[model samples]
Target: MITPRFSCSQNEESVVVKIYCPSVRASDIEINVDDTLFTVHINPYYLRLNFSQSLLEDDESSAQYDPSSGYLTVTLTKAEKGQVFKDLDLLSKLLAPRLTEPPPGNPIIEVLDSDDAADIQTDEDALVQATESLTLEQNEILEAAESDWQLKQEVPEPLSSLRTSPTDRYGFLDSYSGYFTHVEHTENEVNELGSEAETLPKSDRRKHRIEHEEKKWDEEYYLADYADGEHIQELLCWRHPHLQLPDVSYTPEEELAMLNLPRKEYLASPLQTRQLYLTLLTLLFAYAYESRTTQHDPTPESGWTLGILIPAFSALDPPPYTDKSTNDPSTFSIEEVISTFVASYRRSLAFPLYRSFALAESCRSDVASFLSKGRRMVLRCLLEMKYILDHHDVYYVYSKIWIDDFCVWIQANASDETLHQLGSLICSLKIPKADIGWDLEELEALVSNSEVGREADSDDESEDEVERMLPTPL
Candidate 1:
């Protein structure tokens, strides 16, 4: 009989096992606990033995045992904890059956053991053989490779020789040399052409000299004789006979014409001619006065009368009055006649009319002097005229000359009484009606308010009163 008991415990590090077997002593029984069999520390072999013992003790269990071989087998109709024991039992039965059974046939195991040992020995020998063969093959390959490398090295030259030649290489180099030679030849040609071109200017100079000489010969041959000496005389004769003729004296008519005198027929009646000449003289005098007085320079001498002195003398001598009239003109005063003639002269000589006269020879000296003075008077008159024309609306042409001249004359020549009388005369003279074209009342108001006039009037009145108060001068 066999009895078995089992227990198990666990800690942090491993499992602890306790087993009790009554059939076997602990010392004789082996506790082969394959550490690999369970992750826990339970001994599997011991476990199996214990399981088998337990299964055998169980009620209704059918098991077979071989005590001689120390083997047992169990069969399970249902699985239980004791089934683990049956599984071990089956392994042991299969591996270690009764020794009484005939030895089982396992020729494959026998052959595999023998063959494996033989194969190992053969593989060792084959390895050595293969190493030796590889060494020999490598040596052969190295030799063949070296031979091939040398053959490759010698192959290129023959191929290159077959394709081209040294002469062909030289020909390529010579092509560039030929091009440079052509360039050099062209440079030589250009230098030769330049040398040829340098001579052209000298040739042109020679041709120009020839042409100039030919032109000089042609001019001398064709034109010089006709233009000089006798040809010029012939041209002159053709153009004008007088150009070559000698100088000649003037005839009377030509002389008279040159002098621009009246014709003989007109001069035959001395009186009428003299009157005409006087008229001419008067025109000339007016012209001279007008030209001399103006700011512009006079016109040319030809524009004036020719032979003026004799013509004017003949005209003005034996004055146009009879002896009675010369002694005294009854109809008009000499002053009136002189004034009329002067007025006529002034009219004729006004702008846009030009005449010439011989006043220097014709007029009496005193009259000439008076005429000369009258020129300045006429300039003053013209100034007054311009003022009148511009200021036609002004009431008066105030005579500053009268006041200015009277002031100076009184200072030089008058007594106080005479000065007073002169001042009174100046004050009493009525403003001219012709001059008072505009604003007379305004002018009168201005004069009435004049301080200077008032002062003078006061002084005059005081003097007059003083004189009246004294004894009469009788």
Candidate 2:
């Protein structure tokens, strides 16, 4: 009888074995030793033995042949004292009996009706418990989600809070507690540092250094005495003669002649003119504040001495004429005249300091009446300054000084008519236009319809109108 014959073949990466027998059909199998043993448990399984060992004596390198699925294999590379064919034959014989007999202690399935019922009951209870727990967890998660949504909607929290907020529904309290603890620890550290801070005296090195630096700056930048209008007038009187006042008995013609001195002779000095302007402005402010009558003697110490100088100087040194003539010689526009005067004044002085004094004076209560009267001559001077600044793109600086002073006066005694006139004047600038429509109207209405100014019609006038139009009873 031809017993089953086994043979082995080798590939580059794996080994293959063939099993043949008179009773069994030929079968081919392949395996690798590095592969899991569980992989060889398949039907018609094969073993892969290392072929690097020499076949000489029995050693640890020689492994026993065991085929999990009725197949046998022996590696020629790992054979010891046996030929490849003999090793295969030995492996086949060793595995044949093991394959023919049933495996020992095979798993048995027992049917225990009573015990199965109990286990089923237990499993059902566990499932129900798990479901209940899951439902509770889901409800908790939903409630937490709603609460978080509400919090986000109600409060504007920082992004940092959002980043540190717990994402896991169950871990919210723990995360919040940890965050608070961390904050407390940080606060404690800050408090400890604050408590330990030293109370340094002014004599301390750092304090001394700061004090020294402040003292150095104070000494370096000491402010000089401000030159007042009176001082400037004195300086002018000392420097120029035509600017000097003759005896009060002089007639108006004599005074006018003195004022009309040639510009090249008496008004040649720009500095004297600026000083005179400042003195005139100061006097105007004093007179306005005192509410003095305009009809006062021109040569009074407190009257024309300061106020007449400006007009006299202007007459002596008239501004250079421009090609643009006044629209109406009899009643020149106040806005145009003021603009011309300011522009001429600025050009003549070549400095903003003196210009600011002139503007401030014009906005004062006394001279403010002049602006209020809408006089073409005075208004021309003010508008001239404004025009120069607007044309040169320096209106920001000019407006800062002019508008602030003007607003102060306006606030004290502003009228609807004044606001309307102001709006019209500002609108004429064309550049950097002012938004005066609603604002001006509102300011005007506030003053015009005030409760204190409102009054009921007289009884006699009311009766006379009533008799004129008696309505027939309906």
lDDT (CA) per prediction: 0.29, 0.30
Write down the TM-score for model 2.
0.17
Candidate 2 C-alpha lDDT tens digits along 187-272: 22111112211222212322332232233222111111112245333322231111122311323332232222211112113333
Scored by lDDT, model 1 comes in at 0.29
Count of clashing residue pairs in every prediction: 3, 19
Q: Which stretches of candidate 2 lie over 4 Å from their true place?
A: 1-308, 313-321, 330-336, 343-368, 371-474
The sequence of per-residue lDDT tens digits that candidate 1 reaches over residues 1-474 is 222233333333233333333333223343232212311112223333222212122243333434454333333222233223222211111122112344556755434345478889999999889757777767677687878754334435443334332221101111111111232223221111122222223233334323432332322222233223353343222311211234323333322222221111111233332233223223333333433323123333312221111111111111222222223211222332332234223222121222211222122221232223322222222232223222322211111211122112212222333223322332333323222123334533454567568799999999999998999668
Error of 1 at 261 (Å): 5.9
Candidate of highest TM-score: 2
